[model samples]
Target: MKNWLNLTAVAASVALLVGCTNNPYTGEQQAGKVGVYGGLGAVAGAAIGAATSSKKDRTKGALIGAAVGGAAAGGYGAYVDNQEAKLRQTLLNSGVQVQRDGDNLILIMPGNITFASSSANITSSFHPTLDSLVLVFKEFNKNGINIVGHTDNTGSLQLNQNLSNHRALSVANYLTTKGIAGSRISAYGVGPNQPIASNANEAGRAQNRRVEITLLPPQQ
Candidate 1:
């Protein structure tokens, strides 16, 4: 019984460690997808080990299971890391911001670069950028894409909502035309409700009025 308790404690400790580790590329303390998966793997491994092993081999079983879990988690981390590096290089100085959240990559496209004021039509200048993105999307075909449109609180709620929805649909439609399967893409609009910055100033408002594309990994 003591040995079993000890093994369980060790597994829990490993899970905690993975869950709180720093992100290698961003140097930020994020509860990354790798961490979450690793942690869950550890716990599940320990449980399976305890269930299947003889009393004398319980510790060994638990350790082996934990190692396997960590390895699977590492594979996913590497996949996401490669995708992020490619995106950063391709979007350099393109007025687009790439942010990492857990296992997801978010591309923030400011309204100035994506569309004209109060218009749903994409800017002609942004076509090349979208073309580049489409190439990457084709390369990383497994990841799901989510496009969300946001607007500043300058207009009526109804107007903003309609505009935001139209902008999101426009982008979604463009991606479809470029050969991205519609099944892999989901688009939506949230007008002035999920602001990342204050609407008190022009700069803040500009930040608020943006479109975000998030790349999500396949579920394990």
Candidate 2:
């Protein structure tokens, strides 16, 4: 069943990529979103097959498109991850709150700065963090990004997700203001599903309420 889903996703991605429209930069058309997504699908399928199944199945599955195709897909994913790693450093240097999670980086904005009581508006002092994100993302030009908003487990799950999405969009808007194109940002909110620290204490709840910036490869 899982394999079936992966196969379906790959086919859908190929069709999608083949149908993409692009704007000319320096009068050159940019396309191939399908290939990018297909690549990711390929890697995910292989990784799961290897970890939970057999090496033979994994190796055989990877040999699908072409020997080099898997490498290309895997390499591209790693390259995007490397950019995220570098962005972590940039965030730290810029004095933003950041935490590293393997390939994903967490940007924590405490309740004191991210939003007003039960509101999604970021505080005035947090402006610098958004500005710095724009700067860093501008510099990291090869990939797209996803901003996920999070909140403490203090409200309805659905409401928190909506609020989180709003916060992420707010950040994305600020980045757009700083010259980054809106199309380059993918924003969402997952509510309180992922929390870095315990929420039983004040400090933990503060840490729980935050936004995450995941530098993603162009949506393929």
Candidate 3:
């Protein structure tokens, strides 16, 4: 997100610079088209920066993502966003600390609510959210549910990935027992690559120690 912000700033700067120039592409220079292009490019650049790791991939993926995004139902997207926000609030009210980013929701419960250092056994305390989600899945079955696990960047990357992966699988397994189709849900442990908070600060580290649930759009 910070990277997105920076790209936006850079884009604005470029737009300002281009406004003062004569258009070489067209015989008669027009600032209006250039401004529109620059503005759009900035927005695209920011989105790309947030979603991709490499420059070329970011540029290509950003354009493709934009086109696909245009085909997405605007009202449906907003409705889904609102539902996700409501779900996040409900989880928070249930005494779970949640991080909401678009359709991706992250929750970090205390050890009492989850498993030990490297185990996938979700504690009894966390069952309520899982059960609640089962109900949510039934109601909003359009999107695929993705269970992801993360740990503070404290352990070996391989071990961390394994732990997170197991944790995700455990929750997915539990959901399957509740009648959710296995194909409707997927799980992965990102380990430290997608930490929302800093690993340096204790408070931030606590935030990093969490599980993520991502909801993807309906398939065609």
Q: lDDT per model, in order? A: 0.85, 0.65, 0.66
Preferred candidate (lDDT higher): 1 or 2? 1
lDDT of candidate 2 over 129-199, digit per residue (tens): 67766776777675566788888888788888888889888877877878998777788888889888897
Model 3 C-alpha lDDT per residue in residues 17-65, reported as the tens digit of each score: 4544454567666553334445555566557544874754654555444
- TM-score winner between candidates 2 and 3: 3
Off by over 4 Å in 3: 1-82, 85-89, 97-112
* Candidate no. 2 TM-score: 0.55
Runs with alpha carbons beyond 4 Å of true place in candidate 1 = 1-44
Clashing pairs in 3: none
Count of backbone clashes, every candidate in sequence: 0, 1, 0
| Model 2 lDDT, residue 35, Cα | 51
lDDT of 3 at 183: 91
Highest lDDT: give the candidate number.
Answer: 1
Model 1 lDDT at residue 56: 84
lDDT of 1 by residue, 77-193 (tens): 767877988999999999999999878999999999999999999999999999999999998888989999999999899999989999999999999999999999999899999
Task: Single out the weakest 10-residue window by summed lDDT for candidate 1.
Answer: 12-21
User: How far out, in Å, is residue 30 in model 1?
Assistant: 13
Estimate the TM-score of every prediction.
0.81, 0.55, 0.58
